[model samples]
Target: MSRRTLVAGIGNVFLGDDGFGVETVRRLSAPGAAAARLPDGVETADIGVRGVHLAYQLLDGYDTLVLVDATARGGAPGTLYLIEAGADGPVAPQTPVLDGHQMSPDAVLALLDTLCAGTGAAPPRRIWVVGCEPGSLDEGIGLSPPVAAAVDEAVRMVLDLVHHQDEETPQDEPGVAAN
Candidate 1:
């Protein structure tokens, strides 16, 4: 069987650096670009600012989930991060109340977890984040220079991840836990 992967770009294009994910995915999906280079079973989507929609999409079942977004990890702008959401499961940290319009990657994962529990759907077996350090997420229409520069690199990283997973033999059925 083949591994199914979903590369979801999540962010708000209206915000400055917050649009990294959207931009990266846009580049990947461009004509004769990264999307054409991808292998079978790999899918991409720009889930811009719609966390609820992304959460529901997760229920569709994928072996691996790659979330591309601008993450504030206190690094210089354009710094890329590959974060493996631990095997333990989604971490739910107490945060200030959020409105319907905003949802961070962590929040989306938590929501997916809750929704999965209710629907009895299995969450993706592995979750990886291709995050970029943002220079600013202030109200604006475009990315900062550094963030814009990192889009191509982020796209490469995501492709590498998908290819790497494709080469590995699964130790268990896609999303099913092995004892």
Candidate 2:
């Protein structure tokens, strides 16, 4: 069977910079936008702050999951990062704390792990994160200057990732890479 991929954008639009994921997916899924250029069997959604919902969605059985979000890795704002989840091993389960208002990527993954453990559902075969370094996640609307500037680039990155022709070579450690 061909690979099934889900590109989920996670974050809150009300919060500054945190909306990177949501905005990127918005552009991708926009009418006559980049999403139409994607290959078949790929789906995209803006799963904002809904960790539980996202976890449940994962149970549908996709071969790959590409999560787009703002990740603070102590880098300059607007820096893009490509992270391969479970690169080492299964993620350790964290205490289940279901917050309806907010859910970080880590939390969502942990929740998925827990949910899968009970249902015998195998997690996605591969997971990648197209993350951006946020300038600020404080209460506000829209993205910061640098982060805003990176949106188009992030969209391009996600497209490349979904196409399985990522421009950057995989590295041993997930570090800040060029946009």
Candidate 3:
């Protein structure tokens, strides 16, 4: 069976390397880009700084969700990490905050959990996060040199996660384990 997958890029373009996700998806969706060759049932969204929108969109239902964003874990700036969620089940937050501007993937998931429960919508069956260690998130309009160089690799990693689950690399590598 084919999987309906949403690959969402979330972050703030003005916050230096935080734009990593935004830029990566831009390349992925470009004409003749690698994602163009993928089969149907895959969609890409540049949900820049709009975590609430992402959470609401999830209510539409999907088999899989892949979120790409700048995730900091004290590694080298270009290091990549893949985190899996939804396999275990949706989050059960004690007190969820539904911030309109909560852009981090975790916060989005928390908000999603609440939404799905209230609306009786099922969350994605599987979720993955393709993250890049950022050189800086300070106010800026562009990525640092290292983070900029990592965008291509990040795109490849996202594709790999979407197509080949067994070959995922971050199971060995470590990062923020949640969200």
Best by TM-score: 2
Question: Clash number for model 1?
Answer: 0
Q: Candidate 2: TM-score?
A: 0.87
Q: Taking the tens digit of each residue's C-alpha lDDT, what string does model 2 give over 1-179?
A: 87788999999989899999999999988878696888898899889888778889999988889999998888899988988887777666344448755566777788888888999997887888889999998999989999999988888878878776333444322335633
Q: Rank the candidates by TM-score, best first.
A: 2, 1, 3
The CA-based lDDT of model 3 is what?
A: 0.79
Give me the runs in candidate 3 sitting further than 4 Å from their true place. Answer: 86-96, 165-179
Tens digit per residue, CA lDDT, model 1, 52-148: 7888898988889988888888778988887777556547734322434767777788888888999999888888888889999899899999889
Task: Report the error of model 3 at residue 9, Å.
Answer: 0.4
What local lDDT score does residue 140 receive in model 3, on the 0 to 100 scale?
Answer: 86
- Clashing pairs for model 3 are none
Which of the numbered candidates is closest to the native, going by highest lDDT?
2
Task: Give each model's whole-structure lDDT.
Answer: 0.80, 0.83, 0.79
Give the alpha carbon lDDT tens digit for every residue of 1-179 in model 3.
Answer: 66688999988999999999999988888878777754578799999988788999999888788888888877888788777865566555433356566546777888887788999998887788888899998998999998898887777777766766434433343333444
Runs of candidate 1 exceeding 4 Å displacement: 87-89, 93-99, 166-179
**What is the lDDT for 164 in model 2?**
64
